[model samples]
Target chain A: MLSVESLSCRYGGVVALRQISLTIAAGEFVALIGANGAGKTTLLRAISGLTPPYEGRVIFNGQPIERASCAQIVRAGIAHCPEERKIWPHITVQEHLRLGAFGRKDTKEVARDIDRVYAIFPKVLERRKQVCGTLSGGEQQMVAIGRALMSRPKLLMLDEPNLGLAPLVVEQVIDVIRAIHRDGTSILMVEQSAALALPHADRAFVLENGSIAKQGRARDLLQDPDVKRAYLGEEKQGRLIQDPLAKDPLATTR
Target chain B: MLDLLPQFVFNGLLIGMSYALVAIGMTMIFGIMNIANFAHGEFYMLGGCITYFIAAKLNAPYLVAVPVSVAVVTGLGFLLERVVFRQLRLKSAMSSVLATIGLGLILQNGALIFFGPQPQAIPTSFSAFPLQLGPIFTTEARLFAVAVTAATLVLMYVFLNHTLYGTAMRATFQQTEAAALVAIPIDRMRGITFALGAGLAALGGALLGAIFFVQPAMGATESLKAFIVVILGGLGSIPGSIVGGIFLGVAESLGTVVSSAYKDAIGFVLVIIIMLYRPDGLFKKS
Candidate 1:
């Protein structure tokens, strides 16, 4: 559904993404796991047309969309929910949804989809008239997802949906993600949590310094000693903490 | 003293009505575009010219003349937006100010070339008909000006509140990028808003010309007064401009009654005092 070849992104002289290449098949659920500054967000931005790559080709759904405007790319069926959740502060929940469906013209269906989103996220429906700024972290995240869904995107790309939320809320969000995937939307997700993402991701790619370090089925990568040491954190062996906050023991190999 | 009070109030209301029509559109532009439009008064002058040519020379009725003036001025505003303002493309207010200042000079001089520097009065069927309520007297022209301004204001309010485009415009005023992202066609809205503002300014000028006098430089003084009203009203608040205009009209009227020489200065001083006490006007309570 999406292809990237020789993608390199730079912020001034500093390279944020370097010589990256990856692909996602139609209807695939792919998780890209990375440490901080792993070029995950940069990769997403380039594909989503928020940031252009210094050198590369990005083709989605058989069209070269590397030069399309942000709105055009979104209308082309890729919805990007950034990590920070850039919800308009003063606008209401319904207004945010309306904005998400901005470029779309299917009036009746759009209204129906809003209802569907409300059904999926009862909390958002309850506070439909409330301003988005006042919602809790999890509720705001729901609104963000609901907004993306309003676009009726083919690929819903989420960057760190679990950031700064309670574990229970994360579980709730993950469940929503799973349901969204089951309902037939191809998803490309980036997660800091290795184990949680690994179990759900059909195919997983490890991004290190803007390049793919490793790729395989979730289960095989989960069992590899290197993957364990680098991402899984040698937890089963009790040699290192797998926690995201702790330093990985695999740095000795760096 | 009691008998004369009605005269002062009627006169103040007449001036205030003109101020309100012009200032509402100015506030709308400021609120949405954040540009003060230094050439607003020129548009007013253009409106008067259009009205004069249509109603007086072409023998069209006054009712027909008003809309033609508004339409011509609005079209001119749209052309200015597309040719100049849109090219500026999200520039700072200072840039808009400089551009408008230049435009103002051009417009005023252009008026000089075509219409000449002299004032023109409408040659109606009959002239100087007076209406007296007790001892207070007002001309037909002033009374018509007052009535038309109030009617236009009501229409403007309805256009702003009830229409989809109007709501979308309001949304843009609050947050431009967000409004654009929502497919509001922001550039189109901006151009339309500028045209609307210019149209209203022209209408006000035409009205003033009928009741008072018309000249190439007529819009300059009232434009300054309008600026004062906008500031006193608050930068981007429409309702504030109306209240601020009425207050200024009353203050100016009282100053005239007390002493006509210091009246302009007094109106400006009142604005300063109000600003010193409430910087963002009465609307921006937050």
Candidate 2:
């Protein structure tokens, strides 16, 4: 369980996240949907301690971790699979999995967990010896998710796991995510595609311009007219807006 | 000329091993920390000076002096990394370059003040008598230096390829953010890497110091050769540094047949050619 209370973050002079608040109960699948540069990635970075917040408290379980280092945050059971699948290009898939459990002292359990990851992604096992740069986008995405699981995390934060992925691959990844959630690992996913994220999440928070615009049950938000119009592209003219906030320079810069 | 070929090759191999040792350290620091440590050779110089102080002045055995000197320099490296280079990490690459250059000047002057301007030799138990090996001939001290360099390189290879810490270092070199997310203490890694790099260079200085004279200015040429080797080999490739070092050594050795006065120019020439044709160096990492 994690709670972010009235968090405000800035990148130099630009306010990336402005007094945002959200929470995830144990084993709950929560989605944060926002347009590009809506501070989705920054929120995850702030929570993981990559970017220190200017104000607010990030309480993980019962402990406040606002000033913890990235390594400390990871050791405390939060594994962040960052945007664009930041896997090392030259490192092998197996090595990536090994690196994921770097904080653990149990070598035997680490080895067992690696095999568990292979079982989850058989394709990753087949390409275990190969460098990640040589793998296809789908295989790389699988490796990224499998790598996140290697930490045995209590809370997994995935930032755009489906970015630049194919439709079929996205479906497979989402299916795996659902199964992982079913197994009681809480997930905090940031997705730009509202239609894709809403159905899979138990609850959702719609972020707009660094602030939480809407928060409710995923099923309720699915049928909300404004949510449908703004996010799902259900305009009166039946023409998709692509990105309604595309004109915002702040949106594009992030 | 043909009768002297083996001797030339033997001499080249000896110098080449020393060059490889120094260049490998330089390359590792460049690869992992992204710092072109201009003060790297000062570690080598300090190693020699410390070994001289222990073996000649303190009356310690040469074997004992070498490791002690290396450890001292390595400790100094760790201290400098913590106090100096760590702060520069947040600054620009140019800032680090300037800082290291200034550090080099300070170290060079510090050695000059402490050790004096005159070159000094490390007293060793090994005989200076030339040992005959088929067609090649070398002194005991030179042979010992070569043997030590070979063993150190083998150990370095094992550490980098087989150990968990080495793998973590390589992973950090490849992706800093991804490495941190996995709970690798990157700051600690940087400190250890800097220390290890300095230790390797110090080992080279200790071994070579026994064979040749140690002086404050010795580091300047050694550092320049290391930079040349790193550029010729590929900026951060360890194997590249080794091969480049040997090639430069052999080329210089052979250059003596034409004109011994310009033998040192061969390395600079080869580096220019490498830059013109293969700007990425001989072994570009994938």
Candidate 3:
């Protein structure tokens, strides 16, 4: 479980996240949706301890992780797959996976987990010996997720898993996230595509300008008129969920 | 003429041994830590001084004096890393340059105050008898230096190529952040890198002390030679260092045969011309 309380963070004088607070239970898929520069990435970076916060604290499993080093955070079972896909280009995919489990000492368990990840993403397994630099963008994303899984993390935080992938690749990746959560791993995903995120998330939070604009169960929020006018934008609205009254609700928005 | 070629070849090989020894450490340091340690040649002088004191004054045996000189200078390197290099850890390249130059100044003055700026020699007492290579006669001292230098260099090659830590250092050199993320301990690797560089410098200097007069300032000339070797070999390339070193040594020796005073000048001229054409040096790139 994770608890974020009144967290405020800044980049120089520009505020990135301000007094944004939320919580996630173990084994749940909670998506944070926002437009570009809406502080989703900054919030995740702050949680992962790669970025220092200006105010407030983060508690993971009853311990404060505000000042913990990135290594320390990983050791504490939180793996963050940054948006940049920061894989070592010259090192092989297997080597990247090995580095993900750097702090782990049990060789047997580590080997077992690597096998588990390989089974989950067979493309990464096929390209195990190839240098990660040569991997396709979708394959690279798979390698990144598989790498985070190598850490055996309790919470896997991913930023924009569908950023630049083809539509087919994006569908496959979102399916992977669903399957990963169903298998008992907690996932905190941030994406600009609220429609895609809403279908899989048990609960969701809409972020606007560094603060939580709304939070509720995904199904109820999907049918809300304000959620449509502000975020869903009614373009392909029928694809998400069929609310009979939701059609007129889009026009009656205050 | 065929017989005389072998003689010159033997001469070149012995001198190449010394060149390789000095340049190996230089290349390792520059490759990983990215600093030249302008004070490296002075480490060679320190080794020579230790050998001189232990052998000439304490009457220690030659065999004992050689390793002791190396160990003493190695300890000095470890100390310098701990006391000095650590301070400059987060500093820019300029800080490293200024700090090392200051350290070099300190070392130079320390040697002067203690050794009185005198040129001294360790009484090697080794045989001056020359082993004939067809038409040429090479002395025992030069042969020892050449043999030791070759053996050390081969060991260095193995360490850099085959071992886990060696591969890790090379990895760190290529990509620092990636290395750190994998818990390779970048700072610790740098310490080993510096020690390795300093130890080899001492070994090369001690070997040279057998033939040249061991003086407080001997590092000056040897450092110049080592710098030329690094430049010629190409920066940060291990094999390049060796090839460049031998090439420079042979060129200088041949230049000496023509006109001894212009040997260093010729090496410089070639270095300038080569750099203009190919700044990277003559080694396979990373």
Candidate 4:
């Protein structure tokens, strides 16, 4: 379980996240839905200790980890598969998984965990010897997820897992996400698509302008009028609308 | 010219071995920390000086002195990383470079004060007679240097490719933030890498000291050659450094055949032309 209290972060003078508080219970699936620059990625980065929070605190499994370095935070059992995937270009898929288990001392279990990841992602297993840079976007995403799982993390924080993928590829990844949740790993996913996220997550929070705008059961928020308008692109009449004339319909209501 | 080719190539390999040793260290530091350590040459100097003090002053055995010199230089390198480079690593890359230049100055001057301004050499345990095999010719010290360097390179390759820490290092070298997220203890990795690099530089200096003078300014020329090798090979690549070193050495040897007076200039001229054509260096795809 993870608890973030009044978290605030900035990029120079620009505020990326402001006074946001949230939590995830053990084995719970939580989705954070927001448009671009809504501080979704910033919040995940702060929690993972990639960028130290400018203000507020994060407590993970009863320990205050706001002051911890990225390595320390990882050792405390949180793995972040960051935005852009950040996979090493020349390294093999198998090496990425091996690096993921860097902190673990148990060789046998590490091998077992790698097998578990391979079982979940047979594509990654097939391309184990291939360089990551040469893999397709969807395969690379699988490798990123597999790499995160190699850490055997207590809580997996994913940033924009569906970003830049085709609908079919997105569906495949969403299936993997669902399977991961069903296996009892707590997950906090940041997404730009409420339709993709809300239907899957048990609990969801809507982030707007660096603040928590709404929080409720995923199903309830799915029907919330404001949530529907801002995220789901649905009319109050319970119908999905697509406007051909509107340029950049996915753009945030800034 | 054909008969003289073997001798030139033999000479090139001997000098190339020392360059390989020094360049490998410089390449390692660049790979992991993303810093061009201007102070690396000073570490090479420190290695020779330490070997001299142990072998000449204390009358220790050659074997004892070499390892001790390496150990001392490595410890100093770790200390430097902790006290100086670690802090600078957080700042701009230029800051680290400037800091290393400053460190190099201090180290060079410190050696001047401690060892005095004399050019010293480790007393060789080998005969002055040139070892000959058909058309090839070399000294015992040169052969020893080449043998030791080859062994060191082999061991280094094993450490980097086969070990857990090495895998972590390679991961860190590739993407530092991601490596940290996997709990690689990046600071420790950097420290170990710095120490290993420094140790190797010292080993190179110790080996070369038998054949050449170990002077305060020796590192100035040696480090320059090492940098040239790194650039020739492609920055931060280990195997590239080795091949680049040999290439540079052979080029220099061959260049001397044409005009001994401008041998160094010949090597530099060739490097510039190669770099202009492929700025990424010989090993890189670009």
Candidate 3 chain A: minimum summed lDDT over ten consecutive residues — where?
A245-254
Count clashing residue pairs per candidate.
0, 0, 0, 0
Which sequence of candidate numbers ranks them by DockQ, best first? 2, 4, 1, 3
lDDT value for candidate 3? Answer: 0.78
Interface RMSD of each: 3.5, 0.9, 3.3, 1.1
Tens digits of per-residue lDDT, candidate 1, B143-262, equal 778878888888877776555566567667766644543445677888999999999889988887777767788777767888888888887777777787777787787778888899
Candidate 4 per-residue lDDT, tens place, B166-265, comes to 7678778878888888888889999999999999999999988888878887787778888999998999888889999888888888878998898788
Per-residue lDDT of candidate 4, residues A1-254 (tens digit): 79999999998899999899999998999999987788999999999998899999999999999989887888788999988788877678988898899888898999898899999999889999988889999899999999888888889999988777656677788899889888888999998778778888999999988999999999999888888887776552322334344343532221
What's the true lDDT of residue B214 in model 1?
73
The C-alpha stretches of model 1 lying farther than 4 A from their native spots are: A2-58, A64-71, A80-102, A129-148, A157-181, A187-254, B1-10, B90-94, B122-128, B132-147, B254-257
Error of 3 at A33 (Å): 6.7
Give Cα-based local distance difference scores for all models: 0.79, 0.87, 0.78, 0.86
Sort by lDDT, top down from the best: 2, 4, 1, 3
**Candidate 4 ranges with C-alpha deviation above 4 Å:** A233-254
Which pairs of residues collide in model 3? none
Worst 10 residues of 2 chain B by lDDT: B158-167
If you assessed candidate 1 against the hidden native complex, which CAPRI class would it receive?
Answer: incorrect
User: Model 3 Cα displacement at B149 (Å)?
Assistant: 3.8
TM-scores, all candidates, are 0.75, 0.93, 0.74, 0.94
Q: Model 3, residue B258: what's the lDDT?
A: 69
